[model samples]
Target: MQESLRALLELQKTDQDLHELEQYKVDIPNQLETMETVQSEAETRLSDQESKVEDIEKNRRQHERDLQAAQEQVKKYQGQLYSVKTNKEYDALQAEIQAQKNRISELEDGILQLIDEAETEQETLETIRGETESLIERFGEERTTLESRLSAVDEDVAVKMDERKRMAMRVENQVLKVYDRIRRNLRGMTVVPIKKGACSGCFHVIPLQVVMQIRQGRRLVSCESCGRILITEEGLEY
Candidate 1:
């Protein structure tokens, strides 16, 4: 039983190393994705603003063309007034010319308003583009540094994993199971030393009888309060 308990300690150490390595693998990729998301969001916002500004400018140009056509119609009617024969004919031409002039005035007003809106939209587009570019540059440098650190962590995890596998092979199945159970229950800490006659694994004080049994090292003993396999601080070499 004592040998089995010792094997449990060894198994716990191996599993702990494996757990850390697994977490490291997950962390590196999550960090990379977060950086990518930030860059993508900035770019998307910049593009949307640019598209809106372009639409505004296009509408402004169309409005200007409509105003020009109205003005040209007014001019054509005015030029025909000189060729009129009777007073009634002249009056009809003059009325047509006045209607065209009013329509031109309304179109011109609309064009001016569209131009003003386009200019404001263009300024907003430029601001967003500048902000997006700045973020891309800053994020590029930060991502490089983070990726370098992640690579180093991955290499370290690989080396530790090799050592953990060797240790795992030395322990028996039942002992490994108990070690893993304790690790899961205790938040990844399965092996802990006894200190001052108390179980360091759970901080429970060991009775005198159980303490003596642990010291003899003939059979495995557990903490009365915590159910963890107990080991003495003295008498045996780790």
Candidate 2:
């Protein structure tokens, strides 16, 4: 019984190591994707801000062109005033000049407003761009560090897996089968030692007879309350 109990304990250790490795394998890819998604979002936000800034700049230039054209029209009207021979023609020219002046004023006001808006937009975009760039840099560095640590952990897992494989070979097939069954039912922990007259796995008060049997390390025994395989105190680390 003691031999079987010892074998079961060893098997559980190997199984736990295997479970950890499998879990790590599943988690690493998810972590990498999460990091990449954050970086992508940051870039997209920056691109949107840049696009808005560009639109503002283009509109500002168009307004400037319109203002210039208005000024040219005023100049042409002034030149025409000197050539006007009739009062009616002179009045028409003056009215046209006045209309042009009003139009120029409107355009100038629009241009000024656009310039102010563009300045504000440019400043906002710069701030957003700077923040995005800083976050990108910080995330990149953190991701690189995380990747390095994950790589090291992966290597360690592989080493531990190899050790588990070696340990599994030492235990009997029957013991491994029972350990696997218990592990499936109880998640990863299949074997737990009796601690202070209680089952370590479930913390249930173990019967004296069961505890005595477990201490004897004779045939494998299970917790009557939780059905988890029970081990003796010596089964676990001292």
Candidate 3:
């Protein structure tokens, strides 16, 4: 029975280590996933900025074409000025020429505004591109290390699991089942050493008779209040 208690105590320690390793495996992958998400978002922002620049360029080019057409109409109106006989006809041709010139002026102003907007958009696009590149570079080594750690965790867990199985085999079948049941119920230690004559798990005071039996280490004793298997602190020694 004392041998079984020692086996269970050792098994619980390995189980604790395995549990922590499993949690580490989960946490490291989440870190990797978060890094990937950040990089993807930066790239998406860069793409949207580039599209804004392209749209601005298209509008600017269209305004330039309209400005060219307006200038040509002004030339045609001035040529008609030489053929007009009446003053009214000449005045009308002059008014038409002025209207075409006004249109050209408006088009030029619109083109200038579009060009300024395009320049601003281009600057923003470049900024986003740089930010995206920096994020990739800054996180590159960290991402690689996290990936490597994830793979290493698999190997570590495998070795720990094998160790746990071997330790479990040393305990009696019924004792092992009770230990597993208590662990399932508590999600923590199944066997604990008595501390200050009380169950360390629930801090229940031990009866004198149970304390004596636990000291003998002749068989497993349980805390009356907590159902945790009890051992003297000395019993934990190899």
Candidate 4:
């Protein structure tokens, strides 16, 4: 009984190690996904800034065309002024020329404003492009490091699983089955020592008779509260 108990304890250690490795493996992909999300957001911001710059350039071009058309209208009105016969006709022609000039002035001001906006947007886009490139480089480095860590974790889990199998073979078939069932239900804690007259697995006080039997180490004793196999501190050290 003591030999089987000892084997089960050793098996539990290996199984716990394996469980931790498995959890680490599960978390690696989530870490990678978070890094990818950050990179994607940075790229999206840079793209939007570039699009803003392009739109400003298009608006500036349109303003330039409108200014040119207004200037041409002013030239046509000025030419018509000389052909006016009456004073009223002359005054109307002069007023038409002044109105076209005002339109040209407004278009010019709009073009200037567009030019300033385009310049500012271009500067912002360039800054964001630099930041995005840096972010990509940093994420690339982090991914490489994470991949290396994942490879190492995979190797460790494989080694621990092999060790667990070897340890499992040393225990009796029935005892191993019980241990497996308890471990599955209890999250890898199949064996626990009696600590302070209580079941260490659940911290529940044990009856004197149960503690005595666990100390004897002649038979298997399971905790009534947590259903885990119990051992004395001496049994653990033995």
Model 3 over residues 1-238: C-alpha lDDT tens digits? 8788878889999999988889988899889889989999998899888888998898889989998998999999899989999999999989998998999999899998998898888888888898899899988989888888888889999999999999999999999998888888885677888888788899999988988888777777877887899888666553
- Which segments of model 2 are wrong by more than 4 Å? 3-7, 85-88, 149-154, 194-205, 232-238
Tens-digit per-residue lDDT, 120-182, candidate 4: 888899999999999999889989999899899999998998898899889999888888888
Record all residue pairs in model 4 with backbone atoms less than 3 Å apart, i.e. clashing.
none
User: Tens digits of per-residue lDDT for model 1 on 55-124?
Assistant: 8878878877887887888888889888989999999988988898888888778878887888888888
For model 3, the run of ten residues with the poorest summed lDDT:
229-238
**Error of model 1, residue 189, in angstroms:** 1.5
Q: Write the per-residue lDDT of candidate 2 for residues 153-196, one digit (tens) a residue.
A: 77877787788777777766776777767777776467777788
Q: Looking at model 1, report the run of 10 residues with the lowest lDDT sum.
A: 229-238
lDDT on C-alpha atoms for all candidate structures: 0.76, 0.78, 0.87, 0.87
C-alpha RMSD between model 2 and the true structure: 3.1
TM-score of 3: 0.79
TM-score of 4: 0.86
lDDT of 2 at 193: 74
The window of 10 residues in a row where model 4 has the poorest summed lDDT is 229-238
Least accurate 10 contiguous residues by lDDT in model 2: 1-10
Q: Against the true structure, candidate 4 has what lDDT?
A: 0.87
Runs in model 4 lying further than 4 Å from the true structure: 233-235
